[model samples]
Target chain A: MIGEFSPGLILILGALLVPLLRGRLRAIYMLALPVAAFAHLTTLPHGDLGIIELSGVSLTTLRVDKLSLLFSYVFLVAALICVIYSLHLRDTVQHVAALIYAGSAMGAIFAGDLVTLFIYWEAIAIASVFLIWASRTEDSYRSGMRYLIIQVGSGVLLLAGVLIHYRQTGSLAFGALGLDTPGGLLIFLAFGIKSAFPVLHAWLPDAYPRGTPTGTVFLSAFTTKVAIYALARSFAGTDILIPIGTVMAAFPIFYAVIENDLRRVLAYSLNNQLGFMVVGIGLGTDLALNGAVAHAFADILFKGLLFMSMGAVLFRVGTIKGSELGGLYKSMPWTTGFCIVGAASISAFPLFSGFVTKSMIMTAAMEEGYFWIWIVLLFASAGVFHHAGIKIPYFAFFAHDSGKRCQEAPLNMLVAMAVAAALCIGIGSFPDFFYTLLPFETGYRPYTLDHVVAQVQLLFLSALAFTLLMRTGIYPPELRSVNIDAEWFYRRAGRSLADGARMAAENGWKSVTHGIGRTISVVIAYVQRHHGPEGLLARPWPAGTMALWTTLMLGACLILFYL
Target chain B: MSAHRDPKEKRYWLDDPANVTRLVRVFYVVCAALIAIDVFVPKHGPFAIEHWFGFYGFFGFLACVALVLIAKQLRKVLMRPEDYYDR
Candidate 1:
């Protein structure tokens, strides 16, 4: 029975107990829940578990396959890391929300049927918004509301698609439903919104930086990766994703470069990295699929590590703005070291985790004859190194000293970063460990002579360019400003439209009232003249007037008859 | 006066002007060394363009330059005060 139990439920139930526990016990309990789930995940065989029939439709709540198992492992690991990072906080609400968020993501991964998947999908959306709300700022509250609306909107689309899909085919099984059907396209767009596909991407950059420090670490790990998993599960090899993914990869780099909030820039970089995985899913070859999955795995660790380091900085310094931070390496050397590891991993430096995983996607692109996409990917790669690798560290730790000093990151935060950092290096050095966990087997090697040389050249030259630009003062300086993004159309134009509608309604109401007043006045004057004690009918000779009126009416009737 | 300076100020190595100069020089030297490696190794590229000396180097450098320039121009159109949304 324990073996058949859904690992996700274990964490979800554990979330309820968070309020009952005390300080050290609470930390231990939180950490132990993910470990238990991961252990349960490893013991299960590759078959459907937790089957229940609802209204004659079979709902499989747990599906133990390689893909599901791999994602669950990483999800649990990220949860553990986040729990450790947030151990200093006394906020029970955030702790509970983080657990539910991670658990629901894991549930969605193991969901064997569409209905079960939809349930978990909505759960993830609802649970994760609290992370944004935990910041307790008006901005965070507003952004969290926006995040909730968009996420729930995706869920509604998914529900509609599921209903339509079930009608088209009498099965609620979740599998590869291509874009040929209307339902399938709807499902694809739903996943696209969650995956941060270009126009649907604004929520990520908008809301991610608004989360509390520890909340962001959890936020960065789950939502988009779940979408990537869903896309890999359903829409693999869709040619449209190729171009869509290429734009996703390429456009974010420009925004990342100019973004002043260090965490927001990482969020943009996260979008860029997700692009590579999306492209791989489009390729849909064994190598490409493996690349996408492998990159997803690597991304969670590195991106989580990056977000953790920045979170620690935010916790200590009270701000993550690039313009407001510099020379923090003086006060926070361990964080600096870990941040560099994360930056290098994200930038795909050779002997780092990104190099081993990201190369698979590039190799997949070249092999599939997507030469132009490959070139754009290459440009994105270089651009990522410029902004994320060089700029995050350069501005935060090494640039002109902002003359602000703070205490080093707390011990719990340091321990979390160290663990994630070790994993990044471990996976990079031993790619075989991660490759074995991938859903597909591949003979691809990441450390081939040409691959290593090419990657090194690209990264080093990008670094060279950063150096030159900084010296020449050609690079844009970080300022205390916000860059308008796709969200602008809604935040600005949408408000204006609403305002215009409100003004029109007010004017229309005013005009209607004025017209009614004039009509009432005219009617009252006519009444006063005809029936009130004013004119004609109210005169003393009413009887004579009535007789004359009757005679005139009779004469007019006779005239009409004659005519 | 020196004693009145923040204790953390003395711990930062880059606070010294000499150390800053040395770090800059080291960065330039490393760049030069990386570029020099192009002369020694033969590139096994799939395209003819890759056969050009320092192709990746030039591309990386130019890409960064272009990204910054384009982003600078984009900022002219897109940048707003930090409280743009608040207002």
Candidate 2:
């Protein structure tokens, strides 16, 4: 049945023809791929498709449960919006790679078997690095190399886990595999790496900001969310995620506050947002799972919107560094307005998407008696508002005039941002309409008066703190500097280690060459001493001496032979 | 050029110093209103600290202040030249 066919394949196959067509046709064709795929998603039947035997083992190719379907809906929507955002590009490699990346991510989410998931998992890694490399700069090329290694490393872990898991259980099903086994733990770590769990996260802020303007939009939507879906499927309700989620939510915000690149700030914010979802998965209640999924849904849009706005800024102004930009509201008023909408959505303002969804997870943590975790989440909530909610738009568009004036973002980019911004407001305003799509039926209402009051107070107070800090010159000023994170070990310390090794190797090589030269010269001198004109053998009596020595040696050998 | 303004130069209401002050003043009023409402409203949570009057507001404020201050100290160690990696 067509229902069993993977919708992700639509873009994967369709991307092949993108380079063949001319400009307008190519745009229309690329845009049609996702729309067609989304249309196909609605036609899919819920439940596992027929298992096909692959050399004595059965593999589930398509599983269309609410969970997978929910991820697909957002993935396709994001793909459509990202394709629209990148329509201004002439880079065919980027165009093709973005679609394939998005498609493979979608494929990974819908994968029903561990082997199938691994295939799509590695595909996502290989395909997505091009988005970063699409920037075609030396920095981007290097960043993409590191990104590829981490992403492919995640896949390698997944493959090893899958092999071990299949050997142990004799099942390739991609369902909940608890961390009781080493294979399950390996799989969790794989997902954790992609999820940007603390130390595993450097790739996100390192590579994302370097992606080409439109490519970042595509980059932001797919890869980590695929990992989130995998975790939601296999590792939901794991207690460790509670603590991991807190670190994910909290530590990144500190980086966000000090980050100079606006997009990298958004990347840190992305990590913080993922932390919230991770916590939701940890809670494992119906409400919490719904919150996790809903928040993922909302995040794809709001985060994508944020990336798009910054991308437009980078596209026009040639920089996303907060220290180098301000008063851009004058030239790009529409972008500034859209960016504020995105900011409000991420900040979880009362009428924005973050409020309706993220609060569900917080309420779950509260209900489940995760008091310390809840406190950390609350602090993360306020801090996210401080950096992402306020600092992004404030610095990029309002803080101080950098005296840059240019045309507003391309119409295509504005349209894409506007669409994402609308969804953010739309989801926030009519959350019930959006919640109907949740995988589980949770009888939770987001707009209770008490919930509203608590959230408003928290957000407003955080804003007040920001105002006071700005007024008192207490907030750290955005500067032209880099703040080292865990990745610094590799970028700095690791390179230093490598450089030390290289220098040692060079010295070692130099000494060996000197020793070899000395030995060769010594051998030559020894030989020359015997054979040169000044040597005894080279003297005029050398012939008589040679005859006597030969006769003596011959007589000695003859006497020994006789004996 | 006219004494009042140059037509070529663009400006907005936010450019005026008075308007920024007004925005801040209004923001303070809204925050104060939020606190006042928190006093009258019933707040519930899993923990006792959550129910404390003005707890969310005060906690958020203090937490943000601490986050910024600690981050400033961290900057001493973490901050490097923009070209630090490139170098």
Candidate 3:
């Protein structure tokens, strides 16, 4: 009986009850839902449930497998953290949106068929946009619209791919669809867009920063991670993902470094981390696949931790701009500490979650004879440590004082951050507990002597370089500026194209009206000349003209008769 | 000046310029020591280039420096006022 129930349905249906409750009841209800779903997930055995046949097509609503279970476990954990973080808020809409978004992500992961996956895919898009809109800023509104369009566009492509695939293969199962077919290609692009692949990545950094403090935390955990799961499920072992992922991993660090907004920098860093998972999926070995999933699991915890810390700063100080924030560790020591933990975890320092997970992919690359790709990944690793580890903490906490005093984050926010930070450390210190949950069994050890020494040298020397650059003033100062990325083509070039079209339309209308006016005037002149009282037809000799016209007609008739 | 005096009296240890300078010096010494230890430790790098003394340290340092320099130039092309999009 317990196996028949869907964990995602618990959260989705549980969301409907949110508006009915008030005060502490609503808070308790919200917190219990994620826990309930998590418990439900633990009890269910790995098998399919809720299978339905519709018009000769089968839809699998609940499919319990190791991969789905792995993603669902992390999704629920993230939801619990987000719910606790947002407990102080009275925004019923955000609460509902967060639940539905989390539920839909779970639903997507558990979906057995492409049809079921498509439903949850679109559900995630519709539900998550509300978080951005919760900010109620005009900028957030616009950014939310842009996020919606891109997300929904991804959904449409997924639907298209699914339908084409169903027609072509006569089955709707969600599994490996290599690049040999159009449907598979469409599905890959859809996942690519959501995964924040280079050109299609702008919406993430653009919209994530615009969400409310707590809302951004929820937003960070689900969407792109879900896409990573989808990619791992369908496109594992695709060779193209290597270069695609390499580009994804490498390019964002440059943007992250020069970016002023701390939250936006985290967003870029998120994309960079996703690139590692994508590369792992490309490598397609048992170790690499496990690395991909394990990294995804760890990423949700640590990235959410990073976002939570920045959200706290934004909550207290009303800005996360690196230029405007400094020496905040004075006032918000706990939040600062948590932020550093997050930074260290993300930078893959020794004994951190990232070190254990990210290295597997690197090792896989090297073992598979991908010498150059491994080199790029290594360079990216150093670069990530540089921006996320050093830049975030240095600018926000340790640089010259900005003289802005603010209280530490609210109690609920701090508690939530502590929970996430604990998990980050817990996973880093005892990765075996996490490794057991991965999709495959492995004997990979992250703490080999060489890995430890090399990692330390990479990180410590990067820190040294940062110190030297800062002292020499060679490092670029954080300015109150936006560093343009791929979004520029759409936000700028696309807008310009729209403006040109509008101008052309306006000019075309003017010319059209002018031509119509000239033609109308010509017709009016002809009418006036012919129909006016003093015109030739109205002259006093009209009778004589009629007689001549009749005579000419009769002569023509006579000539016709003679012929 | 009176307002400044009270805040200055409440300054944390980390807020002191002397403390910060000392910490930075200590960090530099630690970095130098780590690099120096590379010479004494047994080389176990998988790649031949990695066996070079201080290779990781130099690579990390040069990578960071290059990233900063390249990013600085990128800023010249990509940086705009924060309200660039809003306008």
> Each model's TM-score, in the order given?
0.91, 0.92, 0.92
What is the alpha-carbon lDDT of model 3 when measured against the actual structure? 0.90
* C-alpha lDDT of residue A249 in model 2: 97
Instruction: Give the distance in Å from residue B75's predicted Cα in candidate 3 to where it truly belongs.
Output: 0.7
Q: Local error of candidate 2 at A38, Å?
A: 1.7
A440-492: candidate 1 lDDT, tens digit per residue: 88877887766676677788878877877888898899999999999987888
Evaluation by lDDT, superior candidate among 2 and 3: 2
Task: Indicate the docking level reached by candidate 2.
Answer: medium
Error of model 2, residue A90, in angstroms: 1.1
Could you give candidate 2's per-residue lDDT for residues A40-128 as a string of tens digits? 88877788874677899888878989899889989988998898898999999999999999989888888899998999999999999
Question: Per-residue lDDT for A340-400 in model 3, tens only?
Answer: 9998898888888898999899888877988789878888888999999989887998797
- Residue pairs in clash, model 3: none
Clashes of each: 0, 0, 0
Q: In angstroms, how far off is A284's CA in candidate 3?
A: 0.7
Question: Which ten residues in a row are the worst by lDDT in model 2 chain B?
Answer: B1-10
Please state the Cα-based DockQ of model 1 relative to the true two-chain complex: 0.54
Query: Which residue pairs clash in candidate 1?
Result: none
The ten-residue window of minimal lDDT in model 3 chain A covers: A1-10
